[model samples]
Target chain A: MSLSSTNSFEKSPVEKSDKGTPDHGECLKVLSLVLDQEATDEEQAYFKQHIENCMPYYEIYNVDKAIKSMIKDRCLNQKTPSDLVESIKSKIYQQAD
Target chain B: MSDNKRQSYSQREKEKTFEQEFLPHIDSMYNFAYRLTFDEDDAKDLVQDTYLKAYRFIESFEKGTNAKAWLFRILKNSFINDFRKKSKQPAKVDYQEVETFYNSEDVDKSITTDLRIETVQDMIGDEISNALNSLDVDFRTVIILCDLEGFKYDEMAKILDIPIGTVRSRLHRARNLLKERLKEYAQKMGYKN
Candidate 1:
């Protein structure tokens, strides 16, 4: 699937963080944290704005996100065996006895 | 279930909780077990065992809380305690060794892959799935938890029984490792990346 360009963050102006510019390695960590929603609001704001000016960071962000979506889309498609549910319920009923 | 306090649910309430709160997560639970075991029969057994244990100890689960995370923690623990021992996969590697290796100075050097966004998007499901399954299980678990399952770092920490910092770094390493694997596929496909 094509990446959606609809996020407001992508349209935000490029700006460097006041904490000083993060190196590539630091940027990678920050990117993961931001995407995982584990980063503080300030960190999220800084990375979103900071990525606008950095091509490599932008590419990494998109590629990483796409990979995550792809995994979720593809790897998780296995159907839970239909009989498994009935079996679990029967066992639980047995436990109640 | 946190060890601090356990909520006692009556038998009827226990069955209600299992039906409403727990069963909804069965599909995700099964997917997780399947990913870990890579065998349908083993995954099915694991999920069945997890559900049975969850019911037998239903009193431990707090209502209206994160049943998914609770169930995940149990499944992960069960995998370790039971499945990991007799697993027919390659011999288990020491966690410390893998952690130390990945924590070395080399890991911070930014292992860049030439795989492009279009290339990743172009890849079929099997390519991506195979690359994901190819990682060491520890690395694979982090990605599956964060990326596939969308558990926040703190939730992942509690589920995996590791510090949040370890969760963050392990996930980062895992993503980079996944990209490295994908890059091989790109090269094999004659992409000049």
Candidate 2:
């Protein structure tokens, strides 16, 4: 089934300044930190400001966020088969015995 | 109590503590194992092997400090060692190839094809799961640890036995690859923007 058609892309700020436009490498670094939620307040501010002025950074940021959300929602929910736990316990108990 | 009695009591106490601290992480551990091995039976065996090793090396584990992380480290190492031996397939990524690809001009063209949010939002959970599973083992591991398990970068560094910088770089590459793989699916879902 196809995903819902929700236009979640944020509008890039119309205000453009030549000063804060980060190159691809810097954009990636900030994007990684941003995704991990490890970016410092200053780093976050820098990233927020850069993305507003640069379409590439904004697009990459949103794409990465969506991918992470998809993974967390989907892949993490795989149920641990019930028998695996029993099997592990029995194996551990056998070792003890 | 006799010396022998005292030693046995301590041993039993250690075992009990180990059980208490480690057992609760079974579901998470199993989920990780399943993702790594991609088969139920293999996942079961991997978890069993990991627990056995954890028990054997219980002396090395410091008590009450991130038991989940400790166990995960062991499980990940065991998977690497055992998965290699059992599969008899080379699981190693050629860094030179990856480096060349990323450094190439093609990356600039590819990056412009932004993954449509509607495409990802429309996907079923299994689609996402399969997309994640399609990633290289190293990439998948970082995503699973960082995103799925909510491990901090430092924690991932510890678990994967790499420096924190490597963790960041690997995670960056991993997410980028996932976006590339999913883009095709997004296009199929009729995503326009």
Name the top lDDT candidate: 1
Worst 10 residues of 1 chain A by lDDT: A1-10
lDDT of candidate 1 over A1-95, digit per residue (tens): 22212232223222334446654544555687777777777677778766887777788888888999999999988899889999999887876
TM-score of each: 0.87, 0.82
Candidate 2 residue pairs in backbone clash: A2-B122, A3-B122, A4-B122
Superposed by TM-score, candidate 2 places the C-alpha of residue B52 at a distance from the truth, in angstroms, of 1.2
Model 1 docking tier (incorrect/acceptable/medium/high): acceptable
Q: Write the per-residue lDDT of candidate 1 for residues B1-193, one digit (tens) a residue.
A: 6583788787789888889999999999999999999999999999999999898788788777789999999999889888987875553434453344233253343435566899999999999999999998888998999989999888999898887756866777778879989999999998988
- TM-score (chain B) for candidate 2 is 0.85
Q: Taking chain A of candidate 1, what TM-score results?
A: 0.70
> For model 2, how does the per-residue alpha-carbon lDDT over B1-193 read when each residue is reduced to its tens digit?
0111222226776678667988899888989999998888888888888888877777677655688898899899888888857887576554543233334353474457667666777888877888788998988999999988999999998898876756765776777778777877777767765
Residue-level error in angstroms, candidate 1, position B25: 0.8
Candidate 1: segments with Cα more than 4 A from true spot: A1-22, B88-111
What tier of docking accuracy does candidate 2 attain?
A: acceptable
* Cα misplacement distance, residue B74 of candidate 2 (Å): 1.1
Give the whole-model CA lDDT for all candidates, comma-separated. 0.79, 0.73
